[model samples]
Target chain A: MIEVKDLVRQFKSGDRTIKPVNGVSFELGKGQLASIVGKSGSGKSTLLSLLGALDKPTSGDVVVDGVSLAGLPDGKLTEYRRRDIGFVFQQFNLIPNLSAVDNVMLPMEFADVRKSARAQRAKELLEQVQLDPEKHSRRTNRLSGGEQQRVAIARALANEPKLILADEPTGNLDEQTGEHIIELLSSLSRDHDTTILVVTHDRGLARKADRRFRLHQGQLNEDVTAGR
Target chain B: MSVLARSVGNAFRNKIRTAAVVAVLAVAIGLALSMLVANQAVGAKVQELNASVGTTLTVNPAGGQGFEGGGEPLTAAEAATAAAVPNITSVVGTKALRLRTETTTTDTADAAAGAAQPDAGGPGGQAASVTTSLTAAVDAGTLGNRNNTGSGTGTGTTNGTEPARTFTLPITATGTAAEVDSSGKALDITSGTGLGDYSAASTKALVGTTLAEKNNLKVGSTFTIAGKTYTVAGIFDAGTTFGNNAVYLTLAEAQALAETPGELSSMVVTVNSMENVDSTKTALQAALGASKADVTQGQRNLETAVSSLNSVKGISLVAYIAALATAGLIILLIMVMLVRERRREIGVLKAIGARNRTIGLQFVLEALVLVALGSVVGAAIASFASGGIASALVSSNSSTAAGATGQRGPGGGPGGPFGGATQLLTSVTASASPGVIAAGIAAVFAVAIIGALVPALLTARIRPIEVLRGE
Candidate 1:
């Protein structure tokens, strides 16, 4: 359900114009659990940002569900992000002052979900992500790193977006917690028919995805048989 | 999770800081409200003065200012001519008279001359002394006896064997062509009514409270003036001891008593407005002839008092503006700081698909909540403090003017024809009316909205991608 055609995103660093995402091309079918592995500064997150429509491309286009993001207005792109795409970050960027349930309910509120339904939906999403019910009422800052990551995952699923983007989702966790988070994402994609793309530096995590892509020198190449 | 709920929650994110901001804003808003109240009170007083004493013109006989100046008294025909002048509202003629008890001999004419001069520059100039059987209410003290004895030594002893003789005070009496006194001010009657008809000669007189009390006279009591028995028609409180030691008679009776028929001591001409005072004075003079009459604008003391009141009005207006600005600045600075501190939250909200308008509205709603709290406290402070602040401002400014003009009287000095314009200046009362206070709070809210919007707009410049990437 995603298509990238020669997508290029450029920026000026003093006298040089650097292309973090350059001439990239790829495709992923619906419900596909995919991973993009790269060394530090290899532009793995940049490619994910392009697919998420969080940033515009300098050339070519990113098509998701047959809709081209190339020249879409900022408002329409924000709407696409709010209604059809969700993001999880390495830092688990949950608002520190809000409780875990409130963090999950935020995106639903932005989507204009009915106020009465948001709390119940948020609680169910938190339970689906394996967060304990008691910890759901605690502030995100007071939770452990693994718990915060679980809350972030619940927040991303709030609006039931078709695609999810995870940038270094396990970068701050221990090996065991990181493996559990990856398994949780894989299960969400398989059970809910949701497309998932995780950008990471861990090859072991990358190998667990149905499709594995290696990003080097601003280019992407997929591994045809990874999960099997 | 509504924007309103989030904004309300954010308002109290830092309880101590919120309290501090509200306290500071309350002080600034309170000061602004106080100045606004003072400004309104002074403005009303100015309008009152302009309507009452400010718009009057006095016409005296040419050179009839002092006791020795020689000129023919103003005639009824001249008064009528003045009344016909353009912009002249009404003209009230007055005849000044002084009455002495029959027991007090005129052996001391100099004392009578001093008594004939008005203690507080009445519209009617110098009074002509007349003998009457009515006794004066006030006792002639040492100075009075010294002036009456005609002896520089002031012992009242022409010879060593003669005991000091007692002298009775002379009573100042004015005959008015209207119910008002010579100053064109309505008498504050304490009991009974005014002289029924000013045009006709009647045996009815309005007695001063002090004079009536001293003579054991009440309304309907009888007294004799120039061998003609007159009934006490009214007792009036003139607001001053000197003003209360007098009586009022009809113009015709006073003129006949002075043996000067068809003559008037002076004419108090009311004009339509103070702006027309100078023009009306010129017109009245031209109509009555420069040689026949001299027309002067209201009281000199009134001019000084008005100048001081104008200063008060100006100062209060400026202070009000300054305080309002300070309040606005406080809100602006506090909002800017909040926006800066919450940049991360703004970025996260934007990333979560919150619109720019939603974020801006949140900050504005938060600001309005703070302003509402401040206004409640500020209004309470103003309700209690406005009157005292206004009184202090008027007193200081008017006293400065009075000192600069050196017009404070040692003995009930020369306070224009309306008792004392200086007294009017000191009596200005400032009240914190609800309407005025509400209007002031509305102004503060308006400023606060503008103050909040500036910082809220700054949120638009924050890019979620940039903030997240940096983090």
Candidate 2:
């Protein structure tokens, strides 16, 4: 469940004003599998960042799970990111020092979960991502790219967040691995009753979503009937 | 884990750097500890020496010219008045004189040989000559007859009679034997008893252990000095070599033997307490001057020498303080370098949401740990090396002085100025108190903290974003 109203995000690059996400608006209901498809420089990542509360909108409002992002304080925004939304980045930004299980347990630690329960939950999540229980103790650096991305996905789901935001989760993987990751993410959205939004330029991945939206010139347009 | 634990773990990452820093700090701490220990040991020695020697105060005659004519001995009335001053415990009167003696022999051949020598007789060859010398015989009876069988005979007689000799010796008068406990008192007898009644007329004397040993004489043994047969009543051993050369006798006996009755060369007054020594000396000097009494130059010089030594001690204190300040600066420099090298780690900790206080505490903990380690190692090393250092310093100074004066004594031999075993024992066994060790540790801690504070504050003020951007 997420909503955006006239969200605007601007960037300054050496005295030039660039509107990456300007006056953008969108809404997604609970358990919806949605995709924002756009070419390069279409503000897809910026729009996703705003919706995930990772970046503040320059103007207008973004409401996620009934909390207004535009008016939230920096501390409250960090809490929102930690507790409400799960993010899977393109590069799978897992801490290099921690093992796979430890990486998954990081968000729960930051959220002050009961210490005894965090490890168990982290282990269960790793299994959900098709990572072997034996490999849970392996450091993230020792894992393959696809395995790391799987651990990253498990870490995103550490707190069992209501909304899952994937900013090109399969962008750095091979086609077969990307398909498997997309299938896993879609299955998680359905099984966990989570609303999933993936921002990607992969048409094959976009075609699998239940709904699709095109982002162009800092605006989002719903295109339900269009397929790859 | 806590931020401090993490920082400590990170600090060990660069092992070589940490070891180098630790070694440098250890050396600095060791040097400082040695200096502090040496200073305390020297200070204690000075205090002990001062206590043993007591203080000197000289009393001079009119216009501070002291006693003028040789015959102007201090009067008994003037001495009594001086002794009456507050804090004056006891006074001993001393006198000196020059006397002459002759040589004698038992054989006619030896007498003829001595008579044939030139200047053997007085001017114009009237009779045998007499040499002006000083002798302090105990009493009239103490000088036995020269022709007695126990006395050794010379080659000639004095003025056609038996050889008569006059010897110059110092005569001192005191109330009791206890007044001469140290600095030439009655000898301590290993065997036999002390003199019977210091007022006795019989000839008795207390000879030094060294003199007794040289002449193979002990208690009850008779010896002749200046044509007098005096029985050795006791053989005493004084602790110091200088004190071992003296002979002790009662003032009355010495005066009677010297033939200088009711006369004193000097009067030594021991005060009851040191608190009023200055005022007592001043009052006594004024009284003696008013009475036209005389004093010796030795007494005056003793007073100035002690005062000058005390002033030099004050200068040594300043030197110690300057050395301490320099040690502090060295410690500070070491800590500053340590803090600067940990800046990156500090930034990383901050970015991880560590509180500023927590981060600062990590750095401070690291510094405290390092300082503690250095202090312990340094103290141990200093304790082991302090003896050698003290001996080296003292020997160097003594040898330099000896070289300048061109007076090369036995002390200038192979083992350095203080002699081998004696110098080593004195230097190495000098005590270093716990207080000195504590002060050294405290000084090192203060310097390290001051050094760490600057870099720690800068690290605490670092912003996460700027650090992450490598700005």
Instruction: Score every model by TM-score.
Output: 0.77, 0.52
Off by over 4 Å in 2: A1-11, A25-130, A150-168, A174-228, B14-471
Clashing pairs in 1: none
List DockQ for all candidates.
0.44, 0.08
Off by over 4 Å in 1: B63-71, B75-181, B186-265, B271-291, B294-298, B373-396, B410-436
Separately for all candidates shown, the number of backbone clashes (residues 3 or more apart, or on different chains) is: 0, 19
**What local distance difference test score does each model get?**
0.82, 0.60
Every candidate's chain B TM-score: 0.74, 0.52
> Please, what are the lDDT tens digits per residue for candidate 2 over residues A139-172?
8888988999999899889888888888888999
Instruction: For residues A1-228, write the lDDT of model 1, one tens digit per residue.
Output: 988899898999999998888899988888988999988888888887778876778998988899998889888888988888888999999988789999999999889999889999999999998999999999899999999999999999999998999999999999999988988998988999899999988776787799998888888888877883
Model 2: how far residue B124 lies from native, Å: 41
